[model samples]
Target: MTRAAVALIYRRTDNSGTQLLFIQRARREGDPWSGDMAFPGGRMQPEDASPRATAERETLEETGLDLGRHGRFRARLSDLITRHHSRWRPMVVTPYLYEWKGPKAVTLNHEVEHLVWVPLDFLAAEENQGRRPWRTPLGTLNMPCCRYQDYCIWGLSYSMVQELLAQGLP
Candidate 1:
């Protein structure tokens, strides 16, 4: 019934090249994506003007990093296909891509148990490639995944990363 937005903040280092930010969710029971690796974001609020604002707000709330203070806000990517949760109705997720030029330590909130900076080149590596079986209301489906460090970034997050890398990377 409603839509959400997510921010995919990435950094380009002179030596290491591009790196994407991934946050490890806290081990909370009854959460669909519990203890999984994900980007910084959540559902849009009524006060937010647009999905972009929702993304910025959620990123700040989850990661404690201010895009306005650290990096320049870049272009917003096209909206991904709408995903529906069992409890909630169908919702569209619009993902935004922001590039941080300078380097700074990341501070994650309690909602995030750990944080990782994954190299872009390793996204499709052997160790990162995996599969996840999901039984949604639509039906049973097998989803491809990329696990980096200790977090398994699969499903919509993985799909978003794949699309962003394909369309936004230079």
Candidate 2:
């Protein structure tokens, strides 16, 4: 089994106190989640000591923002779900939440085409409501959706967002 990690990076904006960083995946041929909005992260490398290290490393690799330069770790969730990517087998995805206090300039890699800073208010609004089809070992399932910008941040990302929101925004 493989393991992965993702950082749900966020900061406070002048207009809105809290804003999330979402990436628009670069359109790649044969990529499963191409062009979808997602958090900054990837599969864990051999050099990674732990899942947290993998999260921090992948965040910097994908977004060019170091998590250590930001505030201390707010929360860490483990063994959320394994959203199988066709190229890769089922991966244990660990989600990390970090509070950032600085400029939001993202240096995207080839895997990312564009980025969006979505406000929490907008995400909690009714406009972002929808439904998503999910496939699991049990069977096919349709879950509620949370749309952000041009993409619907459903699936595991949506579950992580809900967890963060339930814990109260930082």
lDDT of 1 by residue, 1-170 (tens): 67898888889877967888888888887887788888888888899998988988888888877876775777777777665544556788888888876547666778899878889888846777888787777998988888665567887789888887777462
Output the TM-score of candidate 1: 0.86
Judge candidate 1 against the unseen true structure and give its global Cα lDDT, from 0 to 1: 0.80
- Local error of candidate 1 at residue 88 (angstroms): 4.0
lDDT, candidates in the order shown: 0.80, 0.80
lDDT of 2 at 101: 69
Considering only N, C-alpha and C atoms within 3 Å, which residue pairs clash in candidate 1? Answer: none
RMSD of 1: 2.3
RMSD of each: 2.3, 2.6
Residue 80 displacement (Å), model 2: 1.5
**Model number with the top lDDT:** 2
